[model samples]
Target: MVTLGVDGLVSGLDTTSIITNLMSVEAQPQTLLKSQLSATQAKATAYRTVNTRFDAIRSAAEALTSTSLAAARSASSTNSTVTASATSSAVDGSSVSFRVEQLATAKQVTSLEKWSSPTARADEQPKPVWPIKVLDSTGATVGSIVIPANATLTDAVSAINASGYGVHATIVQLAANQFRLQVSSDGTGTDGARTLQGADETADDPQSQTVGTAESGFQRSRDAVNAQISIDGTGYVRESSTNTFADLMTGVSVTVSKADPTATSPTTISVGVDGSAIAAKVKALVDAANGALGVIKGYTVSTAGSAVATLQGDRALVQLGDSVMDAVSSAIGGKSLSTLGLQLNKDGTLSFDSGKFTATLASDPTTVNRLLSGVPATTTDGVTTAAVPGFADKIAALAKAASNSSTGTLVQLANGRDTLANAIQDKIDGWDIRLANRKDTLTKQFTALETALSTIKNQASWLSSQINQLYNPNKSS
Candidate 1:
């Protein structure tokens, strides 16, 4: 057996192992730095999310400043319900009549007139004749004619048109096929009505019996009705002709053209207003203050022994909530509901005093507007930007200071939230890039160390083999 002491080679392997261990140990600081970077990035992301949500609450609080619930709900149209009367009447000279009914009822009306078959009124006897005369321009005696009773008006018009007279005749259909004839002068003042002959008997000679003129008597009338309604206990009159109401409140319109007056009872219509739709548009100087107070309160909450403490104590969330709520709470104009005939409850709901509201409205509506619009009177020391924490001034400053697309205070808040989120993301991206570079460097160094260890192991093995061959005396022989 060839004796070979392997302590040296084993020691070399141990040394290589020690170098690999040292590499791993040296990379620990890099790993720790990466973990710290990751934690910082996560914190930034969390804060950004909080900032975005904080702004949303601000918007929701602002929506509460819309027109009062009653004002919004009162916006609607008026309806009409009228009953017509059924009776016959004459329309003589200049006479007009309108029908009226109970405010919520419908009425029906009708009229009538009569005519003989052709030329006589309904009261005329059979074989009767109508008086008609013909005259020249000089009023000279020309002719006379008679139209027999029981003749249809249509036949009389046709006969007159066919006659070789200086006048033309036409029938007017007053209703379905009901006829009445009208005559007109065919020539200028003197030439017209000069061709009529005369009628001395029931069967007059056609040559000289034509009438110089025609006469008829007719009249008709029908009844019309309207409805009346009382709004807020005050009577409001409306015509049955149209159904529309305007400007019950600002930014509101209503139309009511349809109603069933024949129904036993009146129908009630409903209208609703969406406060949330306009919430963000309201000024919220007061809300911001209260929200900030809440944040301060929440931060002081203590966790019990068994319960885990929440991260709600973060100073950023506290400051953000305080900033938004305080801004709204300290806004100018009427901050409390009492100024507008409404009372705020502890739970944040408003109670309306209808009588007081109406009285105040009746006396002065400008006050109401001032109370709602946040436009403070000169006597009132309006809210200042400082009262709302730094929010009001900050937002105004941001709006004026920002050169971006956002110009309004609300837009500034949104832009700020976006900027915060982007900042957090940028930090994360930067950290990721740094970690990736560090990881790459560490990987390359470790790979090189592994290659060096392998080369040294191979060289040690070859040297040991050469030493064994050189010392082998039998192999040389």
Candidate 2:
């Protein structure tokens, strides 16, 4: 329907205002839908907010379960370049010193002869040559690179690199137009060494490329050498193919980046128990638990002031907060959470006593660890016992179940609310079209009424004039 531009042409009434007021009443349903959409969107956002805190709790709990946290050893080296890491198996308060004998190196060789151009020329034209055979130290063929059509130094480099046989080839330009082929093993030590060989004196044949020549034809630039370090004040020495020496001590990984054979300086490594670091992890768990609980409380509880609790009347969300608190306050192995410096406050939030935790950890670390991580149930002779979930593990399980991406309860709740909000928005959008059409129809009806009124007024005026003329036709003055 089209709208009439005229507003009450003869009725002398404000038709546009009337139509607007009528449309306002007609849009009651849409008004209600808009309210519903806002509330539903808020609910979705609140659910995700709670889920975010729950995810944080899950991460902190998982950190507690890690071996890295349990072992909690700190290692340092006197030399700044060398780095060492200690695993759970490493003994606390252990120290070791070692002298760097030499660093690991790869086997490298260069072409004995220089070439005028990178590409080979036969009969004054580019030609193909035999492939460069890469033989291991034991003379076993490990890799081979064939010369491409119109072979050039770039071709050889690409072929050797793409072969993926753990070797790198480069064309070294000693000077402009004086290029030589340089090949090196990608790996260090004797085990990674390879010997390059080409056709033996086949210059007259089609394979006349003397670039990567036969064995003994190339200059041995560098030999594959292993990394060696001597134990301080002891004759015992260790060697590794790579820069890392993982077995020098139990649970200790040592990596040497620099070595000075003639220097008397020795790198001293000390591994010590990191009690403070472990305590910090427990504190993080407590903080995360408190954070999740606070979010839950804010959403579920109403206050004296006028902040609306979006989820105040929700029963499930209330239960979620209660479950998290229970997970924190519950006992493990008949031991209260205070044993780990975790205490529940009156306001339903968790508090961490770091000093108490550190003391407990120092007194009995093994038992403390068990309380954080649950004990698996043992079965014998058809008898089964339930496993006891420890504090961290239990909280982790609950939070994970509530915050997991695919199946978390809170995740699904938020997703469901979002779906509902989307549907409500669709209804609201539909009203925009309906209201426009209704206004057009109302305006057209008023325009038609004005046209009919104008015709009636003209007819009435004509009738009065004709009656007067008939009554006084001969009495004109």
Candidate 3:
């Protein structure tokens, strides 16, 4: 992309200035193209800004229609020992109490006699045969591990660990060189109790690994026990394999951490709807509406003596704020939005009164939810009417229509502006090439003229010299 603008060589003319002026005149169309591109880009940016606000409004408005907000609930316990949680299906005003009688216990046991070596040595023990079987409380063989024959205590621990049917075993050191086998259940339930079936032992046989039943002299450290709880001071007891009780009440889960066998004073449990949460969501919608209106005003509003805006007099964006206002300003079930603490201001923005809204929600929560979303069909007097959409529904649909990526009005408008800007830039680029070519042609023409003029001047000087020499030749002779 080289360019040349040379001065006159022989004609003494300013070729550079001449070519520059001509190119300036020829580039007028490109100047106009650049101006158009800048305008189109500004308009596209304005559209994107408005579209972003519209999307935010859509999200906030749609949130008010969520069922979770309509009946959002929370649960609490009076005592830390008894914690509770409520689900979506939980009733709003249900209260229940439970007295934890006993906590579930896992089966734990230890061998009575210490393992000792057959050499009567102080620091060794006899190794047992392979495949020691373990049985649960119901006498069902849970697992059998074929460990290496003549296994060590650690090897025996590994063998018991390999028996993966809810049994874990470890070696306990009671004193110097005095070790015993301790086995515990992995789960807390009466059904999870385990018995280590091993070689029988007699007093005469010190090395015989007798690890069967209590007859084999084993101490039960803790028995596998079920959790027990009484409901509302009832004498009847409810048993559970685990501490967590999910079926005690509808949509309620209670987990007990301590036991109070005497049902004297029980922990209180309460469940209720979240009023503040609902109010906050409503406030969010109002704030989002305000934001959208603010963006629109910034783009459309102009004072009497102020400069024009990028999107001034834009009908689509001008009507956007009004449309959203109209969608949300309508009454719900014969009640105006003012009653719900969402007010339309004189400047066409939304203002929220959180205190008043929360008060209204506290008094008539059902109506509040209905105003935000919509209620089911109702028959009044004698006419049956279908369900009516509410402010949230209307605003959500409107904002979605204006901001949806595939078919949104502002999105497509911005895209069109971008396309037009790109086309204008293309034309400007073409004009640039044309102007450069024109400058190069002018420079070549000037250079060629300078060469021709120099040749004619040389020929004229030679002719004058020849005439002088010929005329003065006789005089010289």
Once fitted onto the true fold, the runs of candidate 3 whose alpha carbons sit more than 4 angstroms away are 1-7, 11-21, 66-70, 102-228, 233-244, 302-308, 327-330, 345-348, 375-382, 386-388, 460-477
Candidate 1, residues 121-228: lDDT per residue as tens digits?
522422113443544444554444444565455555555555544445554557653544444434332233333322322223347865332221212121222333
| Per-model TM values vs. the true structure | 0.34, 0.66, 0.69
Among these predictions, the greatest TM-score belongs to 3
Total backbone clashes of candidate 3, pairs 3 or more residues apart or in separate chains: 0
- Backbone clashes in each candidate structure, one number apiece? 39, 0, 0
lDDT of 3: 0.77
Scored by lDDT, model 2 comes in at: 0.81
RMSD of 2: 7.0
lDDT of candidates 1 onward, in order: 0.40, 0.81, 0.77
Give the clashing residue pairs of candidate 2, or none: none
Cα displacement (angstroms), candidate 2, residue 127, comes to 18
lDDT for 371 in candidate 3 is 78
In angstroms, give how far residue 120 of model 2 lies from its true place.
Answer: 15
**lDDT per residue (tens digit) for residues 56-138 in model 2:** 99999988884755578877789987899888788888989988888899999887666667674311222223566777755
